[model samples]
Target: MDRLHARYPFLDAARAAVDEADVDLAALVRSGGPAVDRGVGRVESAIETGDVGEPRRVRAELLSYPVARVVVSLVDDPRLTDAYARAEARTAHERFVDDVEGSTPVSLPEGIDLGRLLAEFELAAAVDVGVSVGVDEDRCTVDVGPYLRLASGLEGEEWRLVARDLDGGRVPVEREELYVLLREAVRERVLAGLPLSVPEPVAETLEPEVERVARSLSDYELPRSVTAELTPAAFPPCVEALIERARSGEELPDRSAFSLVAFLAGAGADPETTAAVTGLDPEAVAYRHERLAGENGADYPSPSCAVMQAYGDCVPVEKRDERCERVDHPLNYYATAVEEVSRSEP
Candidate 1:
């Protein structure tokens, strides 16, 4: 693989290059060599930091991106997927920024050039790269539609339409600002092909690496988010049981974790706060609640007790009380408990 493929493996050309090399990804996984090792490290580093650790041997580094994807899909955790995708995108944006600022048409040797990068995402027609910095200091003007598609989810007010310079139909952005939107585009591309169907041999072969990354995420400290102000005392017995285990750093089963998060969210806790309190992966939590959210902004209810019981998510009989017997679902138990708790106060 070339250095450019190693740097931006999400590009279509990178995939085509791998096809040209006739590399058997399944064979790479079974071999458990540099590509697999670096693949695991790439994800671990993403959760711990924000980028795949650093440059390594070109071929191994390029192959590791797909290996990491399979490992992530095998793990099948939205949190891990989001984490890995962000790390890849972050690394690409940084490398592309260097390419943008550090290269000229002739001096460039390795890595993707700016024109090709935009064209890969079909943004060539949308991004006007020609601009006089002496006058506008704007690096480029992105058509309003493409800019909004990529920048709408960005965190800052500056990304908002009202905060931008809009003329006719384009949004002018600085050089670094363009890099940020491209980062989002990269993230979207990486996510588009995730959760690939892994061959049985490859899945079994990569199991250890998958387990390691899973444990890393489970053990990783909360990065940052608003904590939900919650009353555990008012929680239903079953949810309280799960929350206690989560707070103690035990990784709950997927169904159990989803139930707890959905319940807390339905109770008015945002994803960040729920993740903060329950040790759920923030990205997973955000994606879950976002997917299940209504147009009016309400979260769907957690799985009912029967579904939880079938999934073996219900707490043992000892954890329940008379209220639990009376109520059919966890949320119902919570409402009763919260109402009673409020009444018992002064």
Candidate 2:
């Protein structure tokens, strides 16, 4: 137990709080029902056992209470922890948005209360709203790219911006509505597996910027073209769909080419035919097949057939083997090709 205490700093404080009754632990329960005294028994049970396991579990349960809710329950609620979490999220998003906008903190229409919008969503722990805006030179477009973290399961951040006609405000064109639109505008450039900025260790750090963009967008009331220039954001359309479905516990289609190929092979697709369709070399196709076979507990049909199945391309294994013989290792050729291609590209 002492060893566990030394490892986890929070356990000691949590134990002290529970022992002294200094904290109104009941106030931390989920808001769905009548006051449930689950914590008191749980804490007592853990302390009686004197086993390290109980304390660890108890600490986790206590911390699971949303920081905001915890503050509300406390008498002299210092919203320090909750406020810091929100600030961290906002700063990360701002850094991302700034990178997208060429470092010009993209401002929104005057009177669009971004701070309030974020507060509303933060308190709710999730946000789903709409904004309409038009394009201009300075605030030409409001980028939602920074808000990706919020949209996923972490804090449930999502928005749809529909463009309204200036005259009649009809024929709404939602900025994030179309697949191809997001693919070309946001996905292709930014968010293509790029790492977050220094301040953004986690998704929460970008929350503020996301809120700013969301609120500022409500005023423009016109559909504007926004750019997606980040690496991880390279596939905004696909990423968004995946995120939404994942949040709802739904399965999305396999989009990665490699994963798709693996899926088809596992489902019992013929190797030779699959290779031709996928344009992969025969041996490569068989390698994937072998992997799937191992996972499925099936015998490899044939090494040659497996090769053909794995490659999923027109190239024969015989020719590939000849090519492989020239290189010290099979990967050497691939590495050299990658380098050459990178160097040759603009």
Candidate 3:
């Protein structure tokens, strides 16, 4: 648990939030009575109207009450506002980049002056530029920090500075766009708070009353132990494609890599098993597993298909056997497959 906390320091607050009994929504709402109802009504109205700024204000007001925080999450409704969901997910991605950049430092390749590159794009005057380059085996990747978009805007096109391998293909870069993206994430984290792993008795009591609001919480019910037995045949096409690429020593997009790791971890695969399946580094897989796990040892669900597609990881295939459209999250495929296998055995 200490190791898990050390690795995912961001989740410490979430762990604490879940453990506290005072966070129970029913109790809070019952105590607050009319005030809580009025607040919920206002937030719901803001959500229905798609008022961007209003939700933030509502979220702020609701933060004092743990139940109200979950109410805010439900009312904000990521499914209703896909743009909002994407933004939140993007923030998660940026945080991943920040973590990677802080831990792994890479030197820029010789003769590649970042200043000169910025000057070439007329972005030198706009912002301070810093470059962190990572090299794995023969592949080289470059991260131009958060200012790439600013630079791109100045250039008037989608201009990006990429590090190329000897063969001239794009490689991985740990881009920290935190400065630009952190505000919403911080707000969402505060508003939604962390999902607690409610015990079966507690969950049963709250489920009927807070069912809609509960769905807005992060996945908190995933088992600690590997319960679902997965087979290679049951692997989703997208996951299979990812595994094939990983095996061939290809770099995956950060979001895809994250989704794969989270999916494997949530589906009861141990770190070593996850690494073996995805061809990712064992240590990296282990860290990712721990990061996704909640205080009660349940793992979070994988990012949904929309997130995967937004990150360009969703490969469109012609005449696919499985209905990808039916699957929402990547883990859904695994979960469904496990159920199907179990039913067939009986």
lDDT of model 1 at position 167 = 90
Give, for candidate 1, the lowest lDDT window spanning 10 residues: 220-229
Model 3, range 256-336, lDDT digits (tens) per residue?
777777666666677888888888988877866665634212323466666767776677866234746666556666666
Cα deviation at 296, candidate 1, in Å, is: 13
Q: Candidate 2, residues 1-346: lDDT per residue as tens digits? A: 2322222222233345445645443343433221122222221222222111222243444443222122222211122212222332333233334433344543422211333333322411222223324342222122233233222112101122222232232222232322112222222122222222222222243244334333432221111111111122221222223234444544423223334344334334555744654555567656555444332212211112223234442234443534244332212233333445558779
Q: Which candidate, 2 or 3, has the higher TM-score?
A: 3
TM-score of 2: 0.18
Better of 1 and 3 by lDDT: 1
Q: Total backbone clashes of model 2?
A: 46
**lDDT assessment of candidate 2:** 0.30
The per-model lDDT (C-alpha) reads 0.75, 0.30, 0.46
Output the number of the TM-score-best candidate.
1
User: Which residue runs of candidate 3 sit more than 4 Å off their true CA positions?
Assistant: 1-208, 211-227, 248-258, 280-302, 317-323
Task: Name the best candidate (by lDDT).
Answer: 1
* C-alpha root-mean-square deviation, each candidate: 13.0, 22.8, 14.7
